[model samples]
Target: MAKNHLLLSFSFFSVLIIAQISHIFAKNTSKSPIVIQPYIIDYRNGTVTKYYNGPASFVPPPIDSQVQSKDIVIPSPSYHNLRARVFLPARPDPSRKIPVLLYFHGGAFCIGSAFGWGDSHYVAKVAAEARVIAIAVDYRLYPDFTVPAPLEDAWAALEWVAAHASRAGPGHDPWVAQYGHLGRIFAGGDSSGATIAHNLAVRVGMGHGPHLSGLFLAMPYFLGSKRVPLEPKWFPFSPNYKVWPYVCNHCKGGVNNKFINPFGRGAPSIAHLGCKKLLVYTAEVDELRGRAIWYYKRVRTSRWPGQARWIEAKGQSHIFHISKPDDPATTKLIRDLSAFVNSN
Candidate 1:
């Protein structure tokens, strides 16, 4: 009886040890950071925190107020709030329909807010200058929600815009009803946002509707497992390298996933692009310049029945225009973009 008692005691002690070990293991694993730490690692620890301030709500002025802005709340199942800031030109003539620009901001897909001061101001300026109604999408970011989530939000925003294209009055966006030109919609973005725009174009090509007349990818971010010629030596080891898998939930195909790298081997051809025209902008000093040029070349030679054009900003870095809006190069960019949006 004593021996049996001893055995039970040993078993009980063993259980305690195992449980303690399990607890330690869980603690260590949980402590490892799961976020995009620049120049280091990008992992998902299932925690999400906003690093930027969300734009505050404000009452928009009338159409004649140079440019009007308003916040739109889009109901989402995955997110508590998915919103967009809509910018409308002042005094749009009701007799004429205005083009719509669905814009996404760039912050590596992990940062940035559509309502951010810079983004909001930029979109407003674009709307007033290009004479197009701009909808800057505020998508869910990493750690909280991963890849495909932002894309879903973007599509939802588009759908909502389409559904409310003609619905004006109480609770509806008046700018859209008053000035939105649904038939001349365009999708545009910068950096990772540009990547999302490309994916959206692809999905639209694959039969998703509300057809886009043009696609504008400014300082686009496109990548693959293989390094391109002239790629920065540090690129292969940079935190940007890990950004794709980290935000994409460590997708099975890695960088080859069509959504992450539109130029990947298995991705659908540029021929399948839904838009009739594509405008790609690149900065001379940007690391992603090579890939943008490569994309333009491929599209130009592809079977895609669309017109493609590329413009390179001399001695400029990625998204330089956004930061230095008063620069000559930025002015040129605005001019080029305005021409594209106003073109038939």
Candidate 2:
């Protein structure tokens, strides 16, 4: 009967619609070209929980019980009591001032924290094992506050570290004659953190910030786009880095300009303004390779170059070195960074 046919057609269409909806959800959930395991959920309530997708897990190495950890406040307009972590070297000699390294973390300025630095242990180990003091900053995130907020926090932290070095620890002051004058006060970070570090170097070298001794940029993302950052669905290769499901949330309903990205768009060039030594590292396979290379070239052509070095890692991706400890590439990076800090 015609009635029976109509009912059957409706049922078929309903099934089709359900299937399509399910498929779309699945695609969106795993749309990234490169899949990053060990997922995390950041809730509106300020709760952070990690979700592991693979058998591999985060097994932190043993810590030195003698090492001390403390928090120092950095001034920020966007947030009250902006803070940074100070990793004191074990067995500090009060008469000796240790070198300071201001480390910024990478999460595209949207997802990282000073406390959640997965590689904090590595740096702390270096600080303890290498006799250096590392200050890890928790800069502002996007949507809530953009561009200058992050940069401002970075500069403020550097200034605070320089001015309050003595307060953080006995003989921690970089300017004091005790610790060889804090040998080298360097700024460094991975990914977006690297981008900020590079920008700070340029700013400081140009007399915009307190004097800095060196710069270390790892896999920086220095570009901004009006269009959503996610690649076209037709692209074949997956970049291991996540594209942030809510990439547009921050840029939405706002005028696209340098305010959103000071390093992106048309910003003043700092290449010629750096006074201290600079080292830039990039992975060949990283999607951000082009931008990293561009920044490196800018450093060379800039007018205020003091000393610059660029190294391209073989068979590595963005943040890949830090994510995998057993990887030979990661080991080399740590050694090179330690050497740079020591020699510079």
Candidate 3:
């Protein structure tokens, strides 16, 4: 009887241990970390990659008199259509064609839309104040669309805008009809959107010559590699952070070849960019600061007769200059960006 009782006690303890182990494993498996920092990849190989968290729908703020926002649709490659928000100045002089600023939102290629507060809201304000036509593009995101899908969408939108600009206005110069000068096309964005901006500029430059007059990137993540090459103060390892190959695989449900990875694809050649100017904004405390800085340096050192202006907030971090209007950094960013647009 004593032996049996001892055996029973041992068996109970063993079962408890097994149960605990199983529970732990189940918990981890269910909530696995999505953004794992790569261990071996050297981020210096010109890879600019990052990830974004899934987004929930957000209600926009109250509309004001400064800008008029309208939705427009464009055709997509997959027998579908994409949407965009056109922000036009309230008091427009029909006689003069305005320059179009093609803007993309930054949500790490996941949770952003063309009409988001960061991109659309700010661009509208800038357009109205600076008198530029702002077209905030809403490109398709990942998991539903794969790598280059977003890029393709961006290119298509550009072409669509260029093609339709003439018809968008009456008596307006066909080339400058919709948004002023076709040669004055300015592409810009923040975060992942910035990546797209740089990619589009590079591709256009590499091809027949860029239709873009300038490229503006704010805290741009132009790499597809894993590690961010910096010890960031924020949620660097959060599930929202991701790299290429891994992100592309996860996004498309399969691994894609490395040649198409923009950042890892190597530094873009400046000769193809022609004479377009570049405006790169960097946050002092952003995780991708190193990459942005690196890009700025490369562009500044390039052979192109373009200008590279770097605006680093003294005490601002990633997205810090975007949110909360009361913040001084945000105010500074607005001023700087507006000035850049006006000068360009």
Candidate 2 lands at a TM-score of 0.68
lDDT of candidates 1 onward, in order: 0.78, 0.63, 0.65
Mind giving the per-residue lDDT tens digits that candidate 2 earns over 95-135?
A: 86667888888876566666653666555655665566777
Q: For model 2, what is the C-alpha lDDT against the true structure?
A: 0.63
Write one digit per residue (lDDT tens) for candidate 3, span 257-337: 222233343445655553368888888877777767776776677677778789887778776644654477766776777
User: Mind giving the per-residue lDDT tens digits that candidate 1 earns over 216-264?
Assistant: 9998888778777767767766566666666786566887777767777
Worst 10 residues of 1 by lDDT: 55-64
**Ranking by TM-score, best first?**
1, 3, 2
* CA lDDT for candidate 1: 0.78
User: At residue 53, what lDDT does model 1 achieve?
Assistant: 36
Decoy 3 TM-score against native: 0.75
- Spell out the clash pairs found in candidate 3: 47-223, 48-222, 48-223, 48-224, 49-223, 49-224, 176-180
* TM-score per candidate: 0.81, 0.68, 0.75
Tell me the deviation in Å of residue 147 in model 3: 2.0
The pairs that clash in candidate 2 are 33-238, 97-179, 272-302, 272-303, 272-304
The backbone clash count of each candidate, in order, is 1, 5, 7
